[model samples]
Target: MKNYLRLLTHVLLISWCACNPCTRVESVDISAGVLLENGSVIYDGLEYPKSTWYEELADELVKRYGCPCIGRVCMWKCCGPGQTPFNGSCLDTGLAEVNPFNPPVYRGREPSNITAYGTFFYMHGHPCIDSYLVDTADVNEELFIQENGTLMEVAIGGTQWHLPTGYCVDMKYHNNSVAPRLVAAVCFPEENVSTDDSPLLYIAYAVGLLLSVPFLLATFLVYAMIPELRNLHGMCLMAYCAGLIVAFPFLAYLKLHVGRIGVAMTGCLVVAFIVYYAFQTSFFWLNVMCFDIWRTFSGYRGGSTNKRRDNKRFCLYAIYAWGVPAILTACTAGMQFSDNLPSHIVVPGFGSRRCWFVNWLSEFVYFFTPVLFLVVSNVIFFSVTAHRIRSIRQETAILKGAESSRSDKLKKDKQRYALYLKLFMVMGVNWTVELISFAVGGSNWYWIVVDISNIALGVVIFFIFVWKKKVRGLVQKRFRHMLGMPPVATDSRTGRWTTSSAPTEDTRISADETAIRLKDMH
Candidate 1:
């Protein structure tokens, strides 16, 4: 009962921190102007309070500009106390105290209403719209227009006011200084900006994915063909590589067709499921590998007399790695398919591009939480492996008399650590970059580095495991034999083909044994 309780606690902790549910888009036509309900325009189906900045801005603009503002949405900017006029604004409220944040009103018109505020504000921060209509008639009435008894400016687009109250404004020409050209002044929230526009960024990501596939494919082939590489560790690696093969292409499709993928359509849901399952399975495989290493170093083993124990262990790992993700993804999908999700839980690209979960709750529950748990587990595994290596070295030194034995042990240790270090770089660095990118809110260079690093995993694994001096030689000989070539001269004692510079068969066999032993412990 105590053991079961402990196990339950651990399971609950991991699930609480790492479970991320799936998502799908809401059904709404965002392009249609928000409906004026009561005194406020309903934005994304949420009714704003009657007197909020967004409502006031939209209402005022519609009242003055008529149908032009009725069908279009506007961008809002706002400022709080002590914040500089041009430099800062309320990101959440979109209300400004002085100048709007990055107004899109072009000032290059011949009849410039280049007021002190507009000119200075433009100099500091110039976010220009295609064109704006100006109401020069109100120039003499007051420098600022009045809305619900508040003082504000109503700048129009070239064609009429693209920039004003609560960051959006309605236009009426008081001076007859300019024609009362109608314009849209309703502010809607900005769509998410994608860096996929940059050619270099696109190429880097595409190339990374492209480069990864072949190497991973090669890894799968080599592992399947070589009996020496068919241990549990290699099997996990192959599974991870397989996941990447499916995942990268799907990711590319997502980025390229971001706009087309939204709402819980049959096609969208199917593709999303595959992508999620592959990614989660890969992550689980990584965790399994880490656990295997830790168990090996910690000296846990099943009895050899229990012939099915190793097979059972492998089956359990297979089930855990594949099953958990399947369940989580299925549950999330089922909830979404039933159309029973909270409105606050926004599906990413719901009204824009790319189908994904965006709300913080969903992100934490579905994606980041699992990633965080895996990262922590990997760290613990590395620490245990390091300690075990050190302890084994010390013990072997005390027990063995021959200098050659110590040398052989040291060589094996160095090789193992070298490979492990590569493993850490492949897994650890990519995840670290992911965490940092999230923390820093998508810095350009950070994401670029991450894309490149993630794609390099397969290449790193292939080089470390398949392209090694010994492994490469063995594979070449094996291929030659398969191709009906004369057998390479072999070492009489160990029977493995040997090159002059390659390590002796005995040393190689010992290293192979060590690797397989560690894998078996998984």
Candidate 2:
């Protein structure tokens, strides 16, 4: 439980760093005309509430501007029955349809009524039917025209007519402005500015979690039902645990949606634990494999027999492999390491996710550590098999018999090595695709490829195990055991195997004893 909590903390730290929406669009202050809801233009000096000078000019624009989006949904009326403005003012709707056929009027024709608030065209309106197209409008200048309440950029092709109240905004930047402030409506900020939730993201998290629990159970049962799982290097086991821990965050997304940060934390912990476990398991297995060869491989019979007795050795390996990353991640959580190293927000396009063993600063842990294990384990696996090959060669030579057994063993060893290499490649491929996703545009296409490969990984693992006669049988029995089904006996001669629905006295002992007992049969 303590370990679980520690793992959860790590995840929250990483994810919190990476995926937060805090960047907001900066709204700059600009000196622009504000034609208020009451038809008064608050420009250089005027501050009247409802001046008739600007009111007449605004009314003329309402009769002209056309709707941009629908193109035909203009404020223009086809016949003379003009649509009623909601607020009985042009200030209410920014850019609405108007009677396109009506000639736009200007107050300057009656120049005696003109004021500092606004100037009108001589007689006819601008070409655009509904927009109050001003001759004074500059490029990217915040012009308060009627489209909505906010000020928008004034352009020949792009026009915003409605002004006042909540002033319209556009993608225009301003340096300095002396205009009186017109602030925001509310104090609080908004969330999810756009409505896209990236449904694939939720699906990815779900699928990852779904595979994790059952797969972890299955792998754990390998220890419980088959000795091979327990015989796994503690580093590898911890790595798997870390993977599971990290996966919890992605898993608890639905829960995270419900306001439970703690449950969300569980997801992070799972991945951390798995990373820690894998490192420990790798070295432990490397040592075990090496020691087997050093002791002359009595066919790994002796080593396999003393499995549980070697718990202390494995625990140490597990600690070393798992502990380093935990320490490194903890110490370096808030510190910036290098300029090139990508932060949580900017995921590295060429980095590894399962990188505790081979990350930027974890090079010692990631590179030398795993490589040592892989190289050492391969040597041990091959050395033992080589010893057998040599022994069989001598024995066959002595008896004038063929070394068919040696040949077959060598072939089998080659196949096993190839299988492991492929399995190792699953991580490489998955991370590589993730890296590519960060580049080639951080678009959905990159994620699509990465996600598909990850799902295919589990499928690949399943089929590989099924294809192996030995692993297939073991997996089936383990699945049955988890479902609380009656145990299927592997040994026909041992009547000690019973199908009773009730619990047995020495069930645990017999179960453990019979695990690799079927190794010969497979």
Candidate 3:
């Protein structure tokens, strides 16, 4: 009885399985259109069977194919033979088909009675309009050739053509015969013709930038090697110098090699990014110095005595100096790569057009704005600090018995302030000139001279910070200590150099103590 029941149960299960077979989902190639899982069809890369409105279709066509809709049909922007689409228009390859006997003619117009015909090809050396036919005579002066060789009509007597003077016209043979058929038109500007700096100027600029690297490196080395110069101020200077050291070489490299490498290359993008980040960090570090000096003079008690406290303060400075620029750079990178952003929104455009900001507007918005803010803040800080210094000098001048000591302290303060002032002038003036030169829009000799002078910023920094009597003494002491020689003695009270006849062992001070003393003196 149990066996009969088991067999009956198996038969019922088989019947149920036969009644409900599984359905497998498989990908099928559709000839008419691509079918989505949601039952939407993509016909010719556009949504199909959804909108019949011409306006809607036009928008879809523009979004999907970047082509215009004409007469209720999508008119694709086609590149001619030996031409490739770039940016928005066709870029001519050197191998463009040329037929002097058969010139471009207006579409839908007879060849003999055509008002517009090619007088000569305008060869501007630009890929977009190279070998494009120049319109000598047009019945309607408003009619001009576009960059893709299409005939376009503008407003009567409009000056828009002056903006991008060059125009392109692509030709096709009618019925495979010698008769030419004009297909498309393109218009591009000659703005870059006079804007390009002379090759000699570029070479000089690159050379100037390269020349500063060694001086900047030397400045960094001096700060890094000397234990006494490893304080917050010295460390800031070192960081600033290091930023310039990295930036200058890369900038020079870009100036020299960007043309050969091409803006689209990965290496060009990487180098451009490095240069941007380095310069930004340098600016931030310089701001840090200015703020630090101001804080010191404002009677701020933090980061003064304790080593731990100083380190903590420096960590905070590093975070601000490095972190802000990192965030900015990341934002730039994101914008450069993002496709979701609207056309109106400005993007960094790095590596797309060139290895820098795409246009002056983007450059000003992304780079110059932040730099300007920092510079303004620095100016305010310096102003306040200067006022404070004057007040302190007046107060100290009232002391008669300790006049010499007070004078010496005031002199030291002035010297320190002077160093920062010189540094500020070096960077500030250089950038100011750069902004002016960029705005001027041409290779003016006066600005070129200023640019050459700006290139010596590293040398200026070296002289201002490292070529001093005090620094020389510190360098000498550091070298002696490294060589295991007798260290120089200084008067403890006045902190001035002194000759000592004492034995090296008895007169020797710990490096830490010397560093601390140097820190206190500053």
Strongest candidate by TM-score? 3
Q: Write the per-residue lDDT of candidate 1 for residues 187-296, one digit (tens) a residue.
A: 21122233424545655666677777788899788877875566556677777778878887776666555444444456666677677778888888877877766775
RMSD of 3: 22.9
Task: Name model 3 segments beyond 4 Å from true.
Answer: 1-192, 300-304, 398-411, 490-516, 519-522
lDDT of 2 by residue, 1-522 (tens): 897666556655744665321111111111254667865545445342331221101322211111121211122221223322222222212122222122222232222332211321111111121121122223322333222212333322233333222121111112123211211111100121134345556566566656645654444345455544444332343344445434444433442232112221444444434444444343344344344333433442211234454566656655655565455444433221233332223221111122121123344333344544455455556566656656654444543344444444344433544444465455444554554443444445447656665545545544443345555555556677879888554444854444555533222333464332112111
Model 1 off-target regions past 4 Å? 1-200, 260-263, 300-309, 342-353, 359-361, 399-418, 489-522
> What C-alpha lDDT does candidate 3 achieve relative to the native structure?
0.60
Candidate 1 clash figure, as a count: 34
**Residue 29 lDDT in candidate 2:** 13
lDDT of 2: 0.37
By lDDT rank, best first, the candidates go: 3, 1, 2
Pairwise TM-score winner, candidates 1 and 2: 1
Please give the distance, in angstroms, between residue 428's alpha carbon in candidate 3 and its true position after superposition: 1.3
lDDT of 3 by residue, 219-277 (tens): 99998897667767788888899889999988887667533444446887788788888
Better of 2 and 3 by lDDT: 3
What is the Cα-based TM-score of model 2? Answer: 0.40
What value does the lDDT take at residue 85 in candidate 3?
39
